[model samples]
Target: MYILLALISAIFAAIYFYYKQSFTYWQSRGVPHLTPSMPFGNLNKPWSIPLVDQVTKQYKIFKKRGERQAGFYLMTEPIYIPIDPEFVKNVMIKDFHHFTDRGLYVNDEAQPVIGNLFFSDGQKWKNLRQKLTPTFTSGKMKMMFNTMMNCTVPLQESIGQIADNNETFDAKDVMSKYTTDVIGSCAFGIECNSFKDPDSDFRKYGRLMFEENAIKAMKFLFSLSFGNLAKKIGLKNMEPEVAEFFTKVAVDTYNYRIKNNVKRNDFMQLLIDMMDKDNNGGQKSNFLTMNDFVAQVILFFVAGFDTSSVTLSFTLFTLASHQDIQGKLRQEIKNVLKKYNGEITYDALQEMKYMEQVINETMRLYPIAPVLGRVCTQNYTMPSTNLVIEKGTKVFIPNWGLQRDPDYFPDPDKFDPERFSDENKGSIDPGTYLPFGEGPRICIGLRFAMMQMKMCLAALLKDYEFRMNPKTIVPLQLGFGFVISVKGGIWLNVKRIS
Candidate 1:
């Protein structure tokens, strides 16, 4: 009886202390906020809520306080959100070294897949980034252009098949198959033919990585809000099978290429070249191990597959919603391709400025990762506010919310490529646009994703007109997973054009 009474007393004491600590966060600074609940701080019931919905809720709370920035807790861990773009830029770019890490690190000893480029930090990331930059250069991309286009032959034919069948098809699913083939061929140096085989290995694992499931959703939320705690609890951001299969594919491919004197123009060859160059472990060219080689290859496949798939889906979504814009875009494609004698070339893609604007706008609204995170390594003060943020704090750059904020973007939801036009693009602040993030750690695969997207769009627009099907879930809800993904899928119908 005394033991039970002691346990109840301990629980009450913990809750009371949590409330006191949470309330003191804003009160001590003379900032205003709603009273926070015990233990959970201001986020008492966020466990089951969708990420977008949670951000929207937090946004409303931040706006209500009328402060440029405010402190909140993700389960007693203090995190700061900068309501001003200037402050956000300061944290992300202007004074970046102090806040270089993304606040989320996985122990490679336990989880090798989690230790790849998107998650590694410090000198390891710097060295890896330097050694791999050449892989994405315009020269190297030129070498792989044919490999990328090789996937499009299947995509173009598949779209034609659907239009001929006269049945409405989900653009997301169709585009997923297309992108799966593109990444499979380019990254793995294998022909997946996702278009021909719906159960392609790449397609299967791609779905596993991003599908809305309880384990994945909870893992992501906890990882973002409470990194150490999540790690301690053994939460994972990816499926174990994904890592095993991709690693095996990369290792076997590299070994096969070495044994048979195989040479290809895709990303795998570049990995091989980088490994050969960086044997001595210099800062510019560090030692690349067998795992490092496979990690890069696997990361290339994992990162490229879903993001390109989603971007293609959003590209189709925006095009379908704006018929006039679609007509304008199609006309540009027709004119551009005609100049090339109906062959899509690297030179021609660069000339498609309107298509660039369209893609930029799609990324603007439906960024692949709607949220970004940074961890505080040391105490840093905000230049504008002089508010000292202590070490061990987490920060969230709400790319999803900030992009949609009307204060910065008028009629923010409208799909207007002209907003990114040369005339007006220079006028808007650069950091305000962070679809690919900013400063040192922005996405390394941006160039590849853009090339793949542009080629797919060009091939389709040159051939068909797409419209939204009633079957598509409108105002697309995000899939409940680590990456910013849409739920219920994006469906559309295509009309063949002469």
Candidate 2:
């Protein structure tokens, strides 16, 4: 027993000394950093505190100290944080080549769908991005507009029923179902009818993707910290059930379309065209494989539904809290639709400038992706600084902090859409407002997401009035996860507009 105890003690001592040495990396490099603790580094109470909150907190501390950049550690792995907007611009846009990859764990063999545009790196990402760019073009968005509009029909009806029944409902849940239906119709060429059947497979699997447990969280951390080892052990980025369900859906959709010669204007059709080498005349050497097609499909489904749903839900919550802004937005929607003869057309949706302002403000306050992560592809010196960020160093842009900073946004916490108005928006600094990110790697689905959100808001705000329900927790405590989410959900009461 004594021998075993001594051996264990020696091992723990070695680990302690190693961590102590690793923690000095920032200090040795003459960079400012927060003190790190054992095992988790600077990440304190990671399981309890949301990463966005932690990053934002660190950003505030460093920014307050007038530091342009700071360094920290995530489990002995050194991370660089850019606190200055100029630095942020350099990392995201000006010197984007140096930070092309998001540094996320991707194990295609173990989880085929994990090897997606959002998670891919190097030449693969560049090539895939080139091919996928046209997929989200303005023309494609125009093509998919009608299909997206069709999904909103169920959304309006479901919300109208809740309004008539005088019931309090979770706005996030409602918006999620609406976006799920939209993504389902647009991405998979299938009707999810999420409002009609809340337990639909699409909805079930979508929820499973975001549902966090201790095991899921630990697995995520492990994959992030020790990616190679995790890959060797066959760790998955998502639940096996989710991966299987989405993969099967992709295959089934592809086979059915090919067998029947059915072609639609949605995303699936475009992917099918790219994947079918025979259709491509067998000339394109870089044509998409079955795995590639499914990966992209899953990416679209996940990014499309979650980001838009979060934005829509938060916008509703914000508008519900501030009736004046809501009223003004409703008037704008009414005016735009009036011009189009009460029909929500693509062009008409674009005319609702106030509606756009509302959405932007909500995004600024509660971004779907609170922190933007990138990896240093090569050793590069930060412009105007002596510090050299080594290759493979993980960098984080505290988007939540930057958006909520009082320096750029006066009275930052106030839910004011006027900040995003044409008159005031120009004064905002670059790199500070990154709801869709910036530069080449910015969200490819920006136009699609905006259209879907605008359509939903215009449809609902035209006829229904939403008010905050008392059941919603005040001050909005955020849950610990990758996406920004409310702890108990955003509850609201709906009433028909007279």
Tens-place lDDT digits, model 2, residues 1-498:
999999999999999999999999999999999899988998877776666777888899999999999997888989999999999999999999999999998888887777889999998899899888989988999999999999989998999899889999998899999999999999999999899899999999999898876677667767788899998998878789999999999999999988999999899998877767545576564445788889999999999998899889999999999999999999888888888999999999889899999999999998888899999999999989999999999999999999999999989999988898899989988789999998889999999999999999998999999999999998998775757788899999999978
Name the runs in model 2 displaced over 4 angstroms: 1-6, 277-287
Per-residue CA lDDT of model 1 for 1-498, tens digit only, reads 999999999999987876676667766765444566655666645656766555556765686565677666665566677767887898889888878888675767666656677778777787778777888898888899999999899888888988999878877788888888888888889999998899977788878766776655556656766667777877665678887878888888989998999999999988887776666453445435787787778788878887888788889999999999999999998899989999999988888999999999988888777767887777888886757877777777767777887777789998889988999889667656888889888888888888999999999998899999888778887663555665667778889998
lDDT of the candidates, in the order given: 0.79, 0.90
Error of 1 at 295 (Å): 1.8
- For model 1, name the residue pairs that clash: 281-287
Quickly count the clashes in candidate 1. 1
Predicted structure with the largest TM-score when compared to the true one: 2
